[model samples]
Target chain A: MSSPATQPDFGSARPGGRTARTRAAVRDATLAELAAHGYRGLTVDGVAERSGVHRTTVYRRWGGVDGLVVDALDLAGEDGWQPPDTGGFAGDCRALAAEVHRSFADPAQGAASAAVVAASFQSPRAAEALRGFYADRNARSEVIVSRAVDRGELPAGTDAAAVVRAVVAPLFHRLFITREPLDAGVAEQAAEAAVAAALAGVFQLPSGA
Target chain B: MSSPATQPDFGSARPGGRTARTRAAVRDATLAELAAHGYRGLTVDGVAERSGVHRTTVYRRWGGVDGLVVDALDLAGEDGWQPPDTGGFAGDCRALAAEVHRSFADPAQGAASAAVVAASFQSPRAAEALRGFYADRNARSEVIVSRAVDRGELPAGTDAAAVVRAVVAPLFHRLFITREPLDAGVAEQAAEAAVAAALAGVFQLPSGA
Candidate 1:
């Protein structure tokens, strides 16, 4: 049961002089519905019913399911836990891996994610949103890897993008395909393997190895 | 519409003493339907309709959609363009990449593959079938990498499993997530990068790097 009035307008300024309380209510309610029903099961009517908001108000505010989903995903992506900056590549990787494990380990988050991925396959808008989510994460990972390169912990010419892809590929493979729990030890091993391989020259040095 | 009599039993062998031509026709029809309708849209009824096979026959043979899909995938996988036996690591990689491109470039094969992947997310049978497919391909790729190690083309102790994973990772990413055409050039570049990096000592090196 979500209270739609509690949901927040992510990064967007409140329109029509809507109060902060109403927006927060709406956003919070939406999150609850998403967690409970998943993307496919969520509907605007549910949001309106749970939030005690008028259906017209919900429609006027969000447009449709896609808009609501986008807003909800934005909120989730932003409010979701962030990895600690551990000051070095290895530590940063461990922190990042732990955050991923935590996020996917939650039943609600994991189901919501799978639902979104499924919906994305059928909807171009949702696909774009999914891409944006990955792009942001990839950018953060690149920063960490670059720091490693700068420290000479990895070769100068390493393909940072590929390395970043490698770091999370196994985690995602296990999560989405195998539906397996991502143990912390598995995360550590993957991170260690990726780092070791990258340093040894897996992605190719900038010039030639 | 499918012919009812043409369905081949996947479990039982030639119960009606049907000729090989009948089984081939049914399998080909199944693949065509898979490409046309995707996994979700495809149904046993539809396959029966398309192949002129009886629904009971299909069920008796393959069990359900998952079983039918497994048969279709097996059929598709058998239509080979395997890697040539290149003398060295670089040559072997090029051959492997070429094979990847050939497989993905085929419209029929690519669509069927995407359908299979999407289905795997929801069905355990599909997941098992997909895993078997990957494992077989992995085994084949290992032999090529092993040859490289023997020839001193790659460092000893190089992780053949990891290298194979890396080589195909981008192609799958592009094929599944990005929904991009996996062109031959992209495959070639990926293969070259993987071999060069692995040979340069990215993973564990042999006694003499």
Candidate 2:
């Protein structure tokens, strides 16, 4: 599952040194470029110039714009992000869904996130990175579902990953697929619907994998 | 809200004549090209050569690749499609969700539909066309929800469009956003989840718009 772009070899560079600094600079530049001009305007040269890295170094490291986009998204996983931890399952779901809205509503994160999503449609590397990113997130989110079952908020054996996906899928569908407008109301409804479905055992896993 | 690409002026050409034949040829050629190479490989010259239409005619009428993609999708609306008519609300929702999976599973339809969705990311005109297409579809699908209300399957004043979006959004999120696998089971689950939410009164709109 590993690609050359996403799993780059930082030869001869130690941690917190040249390799780390260069990665940060390029990552920031890619986000800025995506916010400014989107995926269509992102270029290897543009990133090199913006990040103050040599053009040759950028090309040798990233290969092309697709590489840059993929790596930038891969960088998102470095922060060890976690899902919300509200006391109740319903509140946790709402908070989780609200986070989806807040990301898109914020200009900086919205542009970069949206561009990464758009780029994934074109680049298999980017798509792979996206899948990995979400897969990690889904795994982490399973904790909430488990907690819900323990607290008797949901039935035992509810599919945790499926419940997490159901909680946020409508928001993404509006944001990226349908290009529809979103507000707090939309986020709340997505959460509420998911909670209701979970309560109804809509997320129970089948007999076996 | 109108764009030249989506709202093309089919000037002075009667139906089933030279203009109609040319449009059909170009549309078919576009779909074939997308199936083979995706949105990144699509080009006006390639389409023109494949369609056997004059290069100048293709350029003058379609403007460019984006125009061709938008128009190809716009043609989909001409079919006067309708939602499934399964008497039970749960059955109707399941059929509706099944349609989403079937579109992406069919060989010819899958490639073309995915390509058009990819193209929409780069072109506002294509995005506009997509929104219009789905808006029409969402409007049409509202009938099932209303029928459910009439049949006492769901509570009255349930937001029909919201329920329709909920029914299909999970499948789309899996197919497009997460790049995850989908199956017949996934489709039925999405339908069941939406019905559970709708029956629980999660989709009731606020007092005012």
Best by TM-score: 2
lDDT of 2 by residue, A114-166 (tens): 87788788778888988887787778778889999899888888999999999
Highest DockQ: give the candidate number. Answer: 2
Off by over 4 Å in 2: A1-18, B1-18
Candidate 1, B-chain TM: 0.80
Question: Is model 1 an incorrect, acceptable, medium or high docking prediction?
Answer: incorrect
Range of the 10 consecutive residues with the lowest summed lDDT in candidate 2 chain B: B1-10
- Provide DockQ values for all models, in the order shown: 0.18, 0.78
**Residue-level lDDT for A62 in candidate 2:** 91
Off by over 4 Å in 1: A1-40, A46-57, A77-84, A90-98, A152-159, A177-186, A189-209, B1-20, B54-56, B76-84, B152-159, B178-209
Q: Every model's Cα RMSD, please?
A: 7.5, 6.1
Residues B4-55 of candidate 1 have per-residue lDDT tens digits of 0101112222224464545555666666676687666778888888888888
> Could you give candidate 2's per-residue lDDT for residues B95-207 as a string of tens digits?
88877787677666677777877878878888898888778778888999899888888888899999999998998899888989988899999999999999899998776
